[model samples]
Structures are given as C-alpha cells and as structure tokens.
Target: MMTKSDDEFLDDIFGTAKAQPTLVPDDLMARVMADAQSALVKPDGAPKQSLFAGVFDIIGGWPSVGGLAMAGVAGLWFGVSPPAALSTWTAELIGVPVSVDLFGDTTAYFAETQIDG
Candidate 1:
C-alpha cells in the first residue's frame, strides 16, 4: 500500500496546473526574428560539381559505389558459370538431381516420394 506522503510527493511532481506562456524581451525577440529571416534567404551562388562528382554523390559515396561494382561483377560471374559447390547446394535445397561427377545423386530421396514403380 502507498503512504500518504508518497501520494503527496507524486502529486507535487505531476501537478494538475496548466502551462502558462512566458513573455520574451523585445530586443531578444528582434534578434531571433532577424536570425530566422537570414536563414530563410538563399545564397547567390554555389560551386559547380563535375559530372563524375555529381554522379558519385547521387549513387552514394565511394564505399557504396565499390560495393555495387563488386556485386555487379559477382552477379555476372554467377550468371555466366556458377561454381560446383554452389550448384550442389542449390540442387540439394531444391531436392533436384544435379549431374555433378561423384556425389550429386538424389537416389536416397526416392523413398520419400510415392513412386508407383
């Protein structure tokens, strides 16, 4: 059970009073308005970026570009001719027969399927 002192302490911290607006000094308010107006104004000119720099920024920085290049090369390599291990893994995953030289047969899985013969 909560004590009365604890209840009073909680009420003091989270009082039911509404928030009241505080008045700002005229000089400080004027300075704040001036700063806001200055921030809204656009600069006259910015330095031009080269085509390569602009393209680089658009596709993210050097790290992202390097990753993309590596991914592209890997994709091309896999598309042209995948390695034997990858083929074996995919074949096992898909439960399909792979024509790898020594250890690619799925004869063991024949028991799992209901073949009439």
Candidate 2:
C-alpha cells in the first residue's frame, strides 16, 4: 500500500527524520542569555491588570447620582406635559406671548403679503 516515490517525497520534506543542528554567534548568544534573565525577573509573578479595568472601577465608584435624578425629571416632564407646552416654552424663550382659548377664534397677529409681478 506504500509507494517509493511518496516515501522519498515525505523524506525530502521532513529531512529523513533527523534533527538539524543550529549555529549561533558567541556575542549574540551572550546577549540572548542576558535578555532571558531580564524577562524572568518579575516582582511577584502576578499578572498585571489592564487599563480598561482601572477605568471601569473609577466610573463605577463615582460619588454623584445627579445624572439619574436628571433623567427621572426629564421623563416626568415629557410624560405629564401637553404638546402645546413645548411651543409655549419656545415662544417664551424668544420673548413672544401666545394665547390659546377654545371659545375665541384665532387670528394671525400680522398680515401676509401677496407678491405680484
């Protein structure tokens, strides 16, 4: 079930199951040994926590709940107020007065100009 050509091809790829020797320069070898010693010198062998965890810890320990209170006030204002409330607020902000009455017929305070060429 084995072919000679396949066996030779496998041997060419895997180097006939023999380990090849490696060569290293004396100066480069000394430098590599020094670097390995430095890499192994951990203070207590504990893994350092990432910067993301530190940021999350600070945000989680924030002292104020002002944001939550503001959100609740905003929700209450939007839910209980009428749609006309926003328009009246805008008019008041721009120094204009607006009146709304069911019994009174509404009229434009100013006349519209008809442009004729």
RMSD of each: 18.6, 18.8
- In model 2, what are the clashing residue pairs, if there are any? none
The local distance difference test score of each candidate is 0.82, 0.72
- Per-model TM values vs. the true structure: 0.37, 0.26
Q: CA shift at 47, candidate 2, in angstroms?
A: 20
Clashes of each: 0, 0
Runs in model 2 lying further than 4 Å from the true structure:
16-19, 42-117
lDDT by residue for model 2 (14-85), tens: 985566776798999999999998888687886877897676566663433556678788989877874787
- Candidate 1: which pairs clash? none
